[model samples]
Target: MQNMRIVKKPGYAVDSVDRALQLILLLQETEWLRIGQAAKALGVAPSTAHRLMSTLVYRGFALQDDQHRYCAGPALHPEPAVGAERALVAAARPHLEALAARVQETVNLVERVGATARYLATVEGPQLLRVGNRAGTILPAHVSAAGKAILSTLPDEMVSAVCARQPPHGGSALTAAEMQELQAELRDVRSRGFAVNLGRTEPDLAAVGAPLASGNRPAALALSISAPLSRARQIQDPAAVEALLTCCAALRLELETQGRL
Candidate 1:
C-alpha cells in the first residue's frame, strides 16, 4: 500500500490534467463515450469529469453532445489537410505508376473520405491520348470505380450508413431499397472479383479496380485504371478483366507477404 503512493491531488498543477489524459486514452478505444461512462470508468466524480471534458472541448481536443457526452475532437483526429494528402500522394506514386503501366491507362489510388473518394495518387497512361485524373480530386463513392472497389469490401451496415449521409448523383438521396441495391452491386463486384465504373461518375470515362488488403481486413486500399469510355468499349476483351484480377491478386499477395499494404 505504501508503494502504491496514490496522489489524490497534485500541488500547483493544472486542474484535472491526469484525468484529461486518461479520458483521451479511453476515447481512443471507441468512437464516442458518454461523460457518465467516462466518469465511471475513471472512478472520478461526474462533475469533475464534466469539467475536464469542458476544458478539452474548449481547446478543440474534444466535443460534447447536447446531453454532455464527450467525443474525440477535430484537433485530436484532424482530417488529412493539404500536407498529409500530399504525403499520401508521394508515397503511393510508384504503385499507381505500375498499375498504369500494366493497364495502359490512367491509374489512381483513391480512398473514401466521408462519402467521397479522394484521389490519393495517380499515374498517366502509356497512350498519347488517355484519361487523366489527378490527386486531390474527390468524387462520389457510389459513382466512382475506385470507390465501389473499396466500398464493396466494407460491411453492409457501414456502407448503408455512409451512403445515407450523402446525396447520390442525379438523385435527391438513396433510399434503403437503393442502398440494398448498391449492396447487391457490391456483392456482384465481390463475385466478379473486381469493380467497374462505366461512365457512372464521369461521362466518357470508364475504370475497373481490385481490392488491396490490409491484415485480416481486405481491400483497405484499391488500385484502379481509367480510360475513355469509347476506347474501353472497344477493348472489352475478357482477357483484360482477367489480367486486372491477376494484378489485384498479386498486389494482395505482395502486401501480405511483405507485411505492408
Candidate 2:
C-alpha cells in the first residue's frame, strides 16, 4: 500500500485584523484585487473580505475602480518628498556608473522639481573631453535631455502648467509659439522612447536621455549620457542608444523588484 499524506489548516491568533493588514500589503504590490480573490487568499468568507475592503476604502487606504477591483490608495505611500528623492538617487547610482563606463560619457540621474531638473547623482566618464560632473546642478527642464525625457512621460496639461509657471532662465522667455514647439518636441521624445539635447542647454555639449518608469505612476526620474560635441557624433548611433535604453530599463526593473517604485 502507498503511504498517504494529509495537510492541516493553521489557525490565526486574530484572523480579521491580520487579514485586513495582509490585504493592505497585497494591494501595495498588486495592480488590482477582487474581493473574491482576497477571500480565497485569506481563507475567509467573501462577505468578510468585502467588509474589510470597504473599511479600507472608507479610510482612504485603498481605492476601488469602476470594475469593483481594489488598488493601492495614496495613504499607503506617504514617504516625504526629500526621503523619496534620496531613495531614488541611492537606487540609481550603480546603474548610472555602469552606463557611463559603457558609453564612455558622463551619466546623470535627475528628478523633476517644479520646472527644474535637479541632478541628484553623476558619474564622470574616462574620456578627456567628457562633460563635467553635474551633481547638485539644476537646469531648466525644457532645454535639458533628462528633464525633457521626464516631462515627456507626464500629462500634457501638467507639462503646460509647469511651463506657464516658470520660463527657462537666461533664455528666450516662453511664448505660446515656443510652447507649441516644445510640445512637438515632447511628442517626438515619446515616440522615440528618448530625448536628445543638441547643444541646447550648454554649448558644444550634447546628451541622450530616457525616462525611468515608476511602476504604476508617470516617470519622475530620468537618466542621461552627456559628452562633448566632438565625441557626441555617436549620440544617435544604435549602440549608444541601445546602451542608454538598456541601462534605464535595468534601473527600472531593480526599483520595481525592490518594492521602491
Best by TM-score: 2
Against the unseen true structure, what C-alpha lDDT does each candidate score? 0.70, 0.82
Please list the residue runs of candidate 1 whose C-alpha ends up more than 4 Å from where it truly belongs after superposition: 1-91, 167-172, 214-218, 234-236, 249-260
Number of clashing residue pairs, candidate 2 = 0
Q: Give per-residue CA lDDT, model 2, range 93-151, as digits (tens).
A: 88988998898889999878778776777899988878986665567888899999999
Error of 2 at 156 (Å): 1.9
Positional deviation of residue 234's Cα in model 1 after best superposition, in angstroms? 5.7
lDDT of 2: 0.82
